[model samples]
Target chain A: MQLTERHRKYWRANLRLTGTLLAIWFAVTFGVVWFARELADIKFLNFPLPFWVGAQGALIVYVLLVRHYARRMNELDEEYGVAEDGR
Target chain B: MSRAFANRIKKYYSFYTGAFVMFVLALAVAEYMGMPDQWIGWTFMAATVALYAGIGIVSRTADVTEYYVAGRRVPAIFNGMATGADWMSAASFIGMAGTLYAKGYDGLAFVMGWTGGYVLVALLLAPYLRKFGQFTIPDFMGARYGGHTARTIAVAGTILASFTYVTAQIYGVGIITSRFLGITFEIGVFVGLAGLLVCSFLGGMRAVTWTQVAQYIILIIAYLMPVVFMSYQVTSMPVPQLVYGTVLEKVTEREEEIMADPAQATARDAYRARAEEIGRAIAALEASGSNGESLAQLRRDKETAEAKARPIHHHAEPFPGETEAERDTARLNFIALTFCLMVGTASLPHVLIRFYTTPSVREARESVFWSLFFIFLLYFTAPAYAVFAKYEVYTNLIGSSIVELPGWVASWAKLGLVKVEDINGDGILQLAELTLNPDVIVLATPEIAGLPYVVAGLVAAGGLAAALSTADGLLLTIANALSHDVYYQMIDRQASTTRRLAVSKGLLLLVALIAAYVASLKPDTILSMVAWAFSIAAACFFPALVLGIFWQRATREGAIAGMLVGLGVTLFYLVGVKFYGMTKWLGITDVSAGIFGIPAGFVTIWLVSLFTPAPDRATLELVERVRYPSLRG
Candidate 1:
C-alpha cells in the first residue's frame, strides 16, 4: 500500500480536477432544471441550454470523466513504476 | 477424497436439498387447496418461510461471512446462478414480456437496456470494485476518501438507491398476488412480506445465496414453459426462437383477414385516422408549448380527441408505418433509457456484491458470460412471446363468449381476474381494453393460451422464485450496509465478528419490516420502478465509481461532491417529473429526464476531482491496487 512520489503528484491533480467538474455538474443540473422556464431562452447546438445541458451534456461528461480518470491513473501508475498487474 | 472435502460437499447438498424439497411439498399442498392461484401462491410462499425458519433453528454459526457474502467461497458457476437469480427477478421474467406485449417495438428498449447495462458493469466497474475488497460500497468510499464525510455521502446515496429499488420489488409482489392467486392487494402484500421475512432471517448470506440459486432454476423454468407452450401452439414449432417468425406471419395474416372484411376495415381505418390526427395535434402542442395558453389549447384538443375516440380503442401502430416523428422520439427515449440502465447496473450494490461471492476473478468473468448466455436464452424468446400473446389476445380473447374466451382466461376471469369491456359496444373485447400491468402477461399467459392449471401452478412457483431470489439478494445488501458500512465503520470499529453477525441479523429483521411496508404501496409496473432506480444509480454512483477506479488523484472531497451532485440531480429530476409537476417548468417531457441527469453526474465527478486536494500517495496505491485484480490474495 506504499505510495511513490509520482503517485502523490498524480492524486493531487486528480482531486483538484474532480472538484471543478463536480461544481459544474451541480450548477448545470440545479440551475438549468429547477430554473428551466427562465433558461429556455439559452441554446446550444439549437437545443435549449437547459435541455442540452441536462440531457446530452450529462452523458457526454460521464464518458469524458471516465477517459480523463483512466488516462491520469495510467500516467501516475507508470511514473511510480507500479506494475500493471499490481492494479 | 479428503474427509474435510467430502464433509463440505455433503453439508452443502444437505442444506440445499433439504430446503428445496420442503419448498416443493409445500407448493403441492398449496395447489391442492384449489384456492385461487393467488391464494395458492401464499401456500407455497408460506412453505419457504417455514423451511428457512427450520434451517435457522438447526444451524449453529450463521457465520458472519455466510450471512454477508455467503462465506465468499462460492464457485463461479454457482455464484453466477445466484447472481442470475438476483438480477432476473419478476421484473425481468414477467414484467418485460408483458411490456413487449403491450407496447410492441417500443418495449424492446427494456430488454436492450437491461442486457446492455451489464456490459458496462463487466468492463467498467466490477473487477475494480471487487479488487477494492470491501463488504459494501461505503467501505470503498470511506477508505478512498480518507474521511467519515465521504462515507456519509456514499451511505446516503446507497440508501436512497437501494430503498427505491426495494420498494419496486415489494410493489411487484403485491401485484402478482392480487392478479393470480385470488387475494386482495393487501393480502398479497402480507404474503410477500411473510416470505421475505423468513428468507431474510435465515442464516443471512448463506441461506440467501443457496436459496437464490434454487430460485434461479424455478424462475427460468417458469419464464420459459409458457413461452415454449405458446410457441408450440402458434407455430407448431416447439422452440421459442423459431416461433417469432411464425407469430409475425400470424399477425400479418390477421391484419389481412381484418382488411378483407370491408366493414371491419372501414371501422379500423376510421379509428386509425382519428388516432393519427390526435397524435399530430399532440406533436404540434409539444412543438409550440411556449405558454399557458398554448398548453391549455393543447389540452382542449386532447379532450376533443379523447371524446371522439372514446368508444374506439387504438391497437399498436404498425411496426413499419411509424412516422419519422414517432421514430425520433422513440430513439431518443431508447438511448436515454439504455444509458441510464447501463450505468445503473454497474453501480447496483446488491448485484455488484454478488460478484464478490465467486472464488476468483476469472470465475467472476466466466459467471457473467454464463449469466448472459442463460439470459439470452429467454431474452431472444421474449419477443416471440410478446407477438404471440398479442396475436392470441386479438384473435381469441375478444368477441368470444366468456366460456369460449380461451379456457384459462375464462377460468381466471371467473375468479374476478381479467375484465374486458366492449368500449365501442361492439360486443367483443378489443386489444385496447387490456390493462398494461406487464407482469400480467406472463402470469396470465398460461390461462390466456388455454393451458392447464398445472401449468398455472408451475408459473406461480416461477414467480415466487423470481421474487424470493431478488428479495434474498436485496435483503443481504441491506444487512451488509447496516453492519459493515453503518455500524462497523461508524458506531464501533472494534466490534467482534460475532457482534457484527448479531447486528446484521437485527438489521435484516428491521429491513424486512420496512420492505413489507413499502411493498404495500403497490406501484404499477415492476419495470418502471426498476428504470427509476437505474437512472438514479447512473446519476449518482456510476460516475464516482468509474472515476475512482481510473483516477489515482481522485480526492475524497471530489468523490463526495460528485456523488452528492449526481444523486441530488437525479432525485430532483425523478421526484419532480415522476411524482410532482416539474416537467412543465423545464419544458422537458418525462421520457427525457435522464438525458439531463446522467451527464451531470459525470461532469460533477470529473470537475470536482480537479478542484479538491488530492488523496495522499497511500490512497493512490490503494486505487492502483483496485485498478488491477491479479494481485489479490
Candidate 2:
C-alpha cells in the first residue's frame, strides 16, 4: 500500500483544514465559556456577548465548520481523481 | 440518489406534509366547533400514532439491507432530519427549555456539547466509517479488529447501554401519556411501547428512518409554536431567537424587584423555619431510638424537603461559585462535562448507526452538517423560550392574588408539577413561593400563553414523537445486538434472511416489553442510568473506534484493553461517587464520568499498541480504506 505524491498532498490539505476549523472550535467552546464573566460586559446586537456566544454564536459556527469541511473534502476528492463516482 | 428519485421522494413527502397540516387544522376546527378537550387530545395522539404506524407497515421488509440500513439510500436532508429526531430524546424536546429556564447561562453546556459532537463526527468518524460500510458498530469491530471477541464485547456494550437508554425513553412516554391522555402512568408506558414497536419492529431502519423524519416535523413545529406565540405576545416579535434583550430587560427589573421586596424576604424566612422544624422532628425521632411508624413518617417529610430544595440561582451568572476555589471547580466541571458529551456523542451506537444508512461517504459528511443544522433550530430558540417564560411569570403571574391566579396555575398544580405556598401568610404569589418543575414549564407553555387546547395537544404529540423516535432506535440497536451480531453473525451463519429477520423481530418485541415493564415500576434509578449511558459509550468506544479507523498499527489486543480500561475507569468513578462515599473529582459529576475514562482510554491504547505487535497487512489496509474517502478498489 504505497502512497503517491498526489495522495500525500490531498491528505495534507484535508488535515490542515481540519486543524484550522478545530482551532476555531476550541476558541468558541472552551475559551468563550471560560471567560464568560469578563465577556458579559461586552454586548453584541443588544445581547450580552457571552450569552449570545453560548446560546447561538457557537452553534452557528459549529454548523458552518462541518459544512465547510464536507464541501472542501468533496472538491478535494474530485481534484485528486479519487471520488467514489470516479470524477 | 438520482435526481428523479430525489424528486419523487420530495413529491411524496410534500403531500405528506400537506396532509399532516390538514389533520392538525381539522382538529383545531373541531376544537372550535365545541369538541371536548379530552377528545381533542385523544384525536391528536391517535392520529399521529396511526400515521407513523401506517408508514411502518408500508416500509415492512424481509430484505436484510433495507431492514438494517434502510437500503443505504436515504437522502441527506431526510437522514439529517431523522438523525435529529433520533438524537433528540425526551430530554431535549420536553426538558431543554425547562433546563434553560432553571439553569440560565450554565445550561448551554448541554446545547453546545450535544451539537458540537456532530462536528467531531464529520471530521473524525462519519466519512471514514460510511466508507467502511457496516451494518452496525459491532460489524466494524469484527471486521477491523479481525475477530469475534471485539465484536462480542461491542454487542454486550451496545445492549447494556441501549437497554437502559430505551427504558428511560419509555419512562418519558409514560410521563407524557399520563400528563396528556389522562391515563395512569403504567398504562401510558404500555400504550407508548406499542407505538414504538410498530415503527422499528416492522420495517426496521427503513421504517424507523421515515417515521423519524415525520416525527422530526411534528416535534420541531410543536416545539416552536409556543415559543413563537409567546415572543409575539411579549415583544411583538415572532422570531424568538433575535429578541433576547428585549425581554431580558423586563426580567432583570423583576428579579431586582423580587430580591429587594420585603415580602420575598419574609417568604424565604418562612421556608427556612418550616424546613428547620421538619429537620428537628426527624432528629427527635432518631434520638429517641424508635423505629416506629412516627419515625418513618418524619423521615419521609425530611426526604420531601431534600427533594424539593431548589438552590439559589442568579439568572445572569455564567458559573456560580461564591469563592475563588469554588469558581475554579465550577469551571473545571463545566469544561469536563462539555468534553465528555462531545466524545460520547461521536461514540453513541444508536447515533453512529444512522451514518450507515447514507448512500456515500460524501453524503455522510454532509448529513452530519444537516443534523447539526436541524438540531440548532431548537437549541437556538430554547434560551429565548426560557427568557420569555420568565418574563411572563415576572410580569403577570407574580404579585397576583393567589385566589385570582390563572386557571393554568391551578391546572398544573393539580398534577403537583407546580407547587404554590403562601409562606408569608400573604395571598399574593411571590416568585420565591412558586416552585415549577422543569416538565411543567414546557407542558404548561400553551396554557400559560392562553393558546387553545389543540396547541397543548400538539405539544404533547411533539413530546411523544421525540420519545418514540429515540426509543425506536434504541430498541432496534438492542435487538440487533442479539439478533444480528450474536444470532446471525455468530450462532447461525447459514440462516436464511427470513429466519434472521424473524429472530430480530421477536427479540425486538421481547426487549421492548422488558423496557416497558421496568419503566412502569417507576424507579428513579433508570434516570440515573440514562446519564451513565453517555459515559459508558464514551469510555467503551471513543478510543477504540477512533484509533481503529485512523491508526493502522492499532492491534486487536490494544483495542480490547483500551475499551476495557476505559469502561473500568468510568464505572469505578461512577460507583465511587454514587455508593463509595467518594467526593467528585474536581467537582465533576458522575454524569460526565467519561472525563476520566476518555483520557485513560487514549493513553492505554497508545501504551498497549506500542507494546503489542502491529496488526497484519490486510487489517492495516482496512484502516487505510476507512480513512480515505476516494480509495480505489
Candidate 3:
C-alpha cells in the first residue's frame, strides 16, 4: 500500500483538468450575471446577451462543462491505467 | 449486473415507457369523449402512484447491499435519471417555471446554481465518494474522519435537512393534489405520503432509485409537453429555446404598452390609496395600544393587501429596481444564493447517496453528466415556458373586453386563484385588472393555451412524480440515518441484517407520517423553507466532506468542530434574521446565510486540524485511495 509516482501524476492531471474547467465555470457563472446589463446592449441576432445567458446559455454551458469533464476524466483514467470497470 | 441483466432492464423500461405513453393517450381520448375532468385528475393520481408502488414491490430486497446501495451496480444512464429525479424536488419541477415567470432574470440563480452544482459533483465529490464506496454519506464521515462522533453529527444533520426538505415536498403535494383531485389539503398530504412510503419503504435505496428514474421520465415529459405545445401554438415553432428570443421581445413590447395605459395608472393609484389607508389604520392601532384582537384583524388585512400586490417590474428587467443601490443588493444576493445552492447540492445526503448506487467511480462521473443532461431538459425550457406563458397572456388575454375573457379565467377566478376586475370601469382588461399568482402559470398553461383538460391532468401527474420521487429519496435518507447510523452503528453493532432492514422500513414510515402532519399544518412558503434547508446542508457537510477527501489531516475532532461551527453560524444568522428582527449583516440576506457558515466551517477545520494531532496512517491511506483511483493497496 505504498504511494507511487504514477498515482501522484494521475492525481495531478485530474486536478489540472478540474482547475481549468472550473476557472471557465467561474467566469461564465458570475460574468454573465455581473455584466448582464452591459451584455444586454451587445445583442447577437437581436436576443439580449443578458436575457439569453441567464435564461438558456448558462445552462447549455453547464451541460457542456460536465460532459467535457466526464469525457476527459475517463480518458485520463484510461491513460493512467486507473480506469474502473467501465459500467 | 451482467450484460444480460442490463439488457433485460432496458427492455423492461422500454415497454414501460410505451405503456405509460399509451395510458396517457387513452386518458386524452377519454377526455375528448366527454369524460369528466375530476375523473381524469383522480385517475392520474391513482395510476401514477400505483405505478411507483408496483415498482417498489417488484424491486423489494432483503439483502443489505441491495437495501443500501442497490448492490452498487446501477448503470450510468439509469443512475443519471434517478439523480435528476432525486435532484428535482417539487420546487424544481413545479416552482421553478413559476419563479422564472415571477422573478424574471433573477430566477436564473436557482437554475444556474442547481445545474452548476453538478459540476462540483463531477469534478470534486462524486467520483471520489464512489471510489470510497459507501452506502451513505455518514459512512464516509465515520470511516475517513475516524469516529462515531463525526458519524453521529453527520447523521443528525442529514436527518434534519432531509426532514425539512421532505416536508416541503409533501406540502407541495398538498397544494398540487388538492388542487387537482378536489380533496382537502389535509387529505392531500397523506395521499402524497402514501405515494412516498410505497416507493421507499419496501426496498430502501433500491426502490427509491428505480422509482426516481421512472418519475424523472414522467416529470420531464409533463413539464415539456405543455410548454412545447404553447411555443408552437404561439410561434409555429416547437423548439421553445430557439423561439424564446422572439417571444421575449414581443413580451417586452407588450409590457411597455401596458405600462403606458392610463387605466393602468388609475389602477396603481387605487392600490396606493388602499395601502395608505391600511398604514393609517395600523398607526392608529399602535397609538391606542392595540389589543391582540385588533392586531390579529389588522394582520389579516395586511395579508390580504400583500396578496393583492401586483408585479411592478417587467419580466425583462434586470432586477428588482433601476437604482444602482438596489441593483448592487440584487447582484450580491444572487451570487450568495447561487454559491450556497451549489455547495448544498454537493453536500445533501440524499443527492450524495445517489453516487453510491453506481457500480464504480467511472459510472459515478458518467452519471453526473447524464443527470445534468436530463435535468437540462427541464431547466433549459423553464425560462422559455415563462416567456411564452407571458406571451399567451399579453397577446390573447390583456386589453380584451371583459365580456370576452376565457372560461379558464372565470374558473380560476371562482377559485380565488386569479383576480380580474375592471377597476377603472373601462370594461376592458388592463394588466392591473388581472392579478395572477405566479404559481398558476405552469399549472394553468394547458388551459390557457386552449389545450384540453387532459394535458392539465398530465401536468398534475408530472408534478406529483417530482414531489414523490424527491420525497422518497429524502425519506430513505432520514430513515437510513436513524436505523443504520444511530441504531446499528451505535446501539446494536451486531444487529441482524434483516432486523436493520425492518427498522429502516419502519422508520421510513414513521418519518413519512410525521412529515405529512407537518405538511398538513401548511408552513409558510415552500421555497423559503427549502432554501433554509439548503443553507444548513451547505454549511454543515460541505466543508467536512470536501476536506475529509483532500486533507487526510482532518481529524475527527476537526470534522466535529467544523460541523458545529458551520451549523452554529447558519442557525444563528437564520434565526436572528428570520425571527429576531436582526438587521442583515453586510446585506447577506437570510436565504444565503450559508455563505457565512461555509467560510467559518472551512477556516475552523483548517485551524483545528493543524492544532490537533494528524489523522493516523490508515486514514491517510484511505485518502490516497479516494484521490487516485488506481492507488489500491
List clashing residue pairs in candidate 3: none
Interface RMSD of each: 11.7, 2.0, 1.7
Query: Between candidates 2 and 3, which one is better according to DockQ?
Result: 3
Per-residue CA lDDT of model 2 for B68-129, tens digit only, reads 99999898888999999999999998888898898888888888998898888888889888
Give candidate 2's chain B TM-score.
0.96
Per-residue lDDT of B542 in model 3: 93
lDDT score of model 3? 0.85
The whole-model lDDT of each prediction reads 0.63, 0.87, 0.85
Question: Rank by lDDT, descending?
Answer: 2, 3, 1
Residue A11 error, candidate 2, Å: 1.9
Candidate 3 lDDT over residue span B354-440, tens digit each: 999887787788899999899888888888888887888887898889999989898888778788877668888877668777778
What are the runs in model 2 whose C-alpha is more than 4 Å off? B288-312
C-alpha lDDT (0 to 100) for residue B525 of candidate 2: 76
DockQ for every prediction shown: 0.04, 0.65, 0.67
Residue B511 lDDT, candidate 1, scale 0-100: 82
- Candidate 1 lDDT score at position A80: 49
Runs of candidate 1 with Cα error greater than 4 angstroms are A1-87, B1-62, B177-183, B256-323, B398-404, B414-417, B429-437, B521-530, B583-592, B631-633
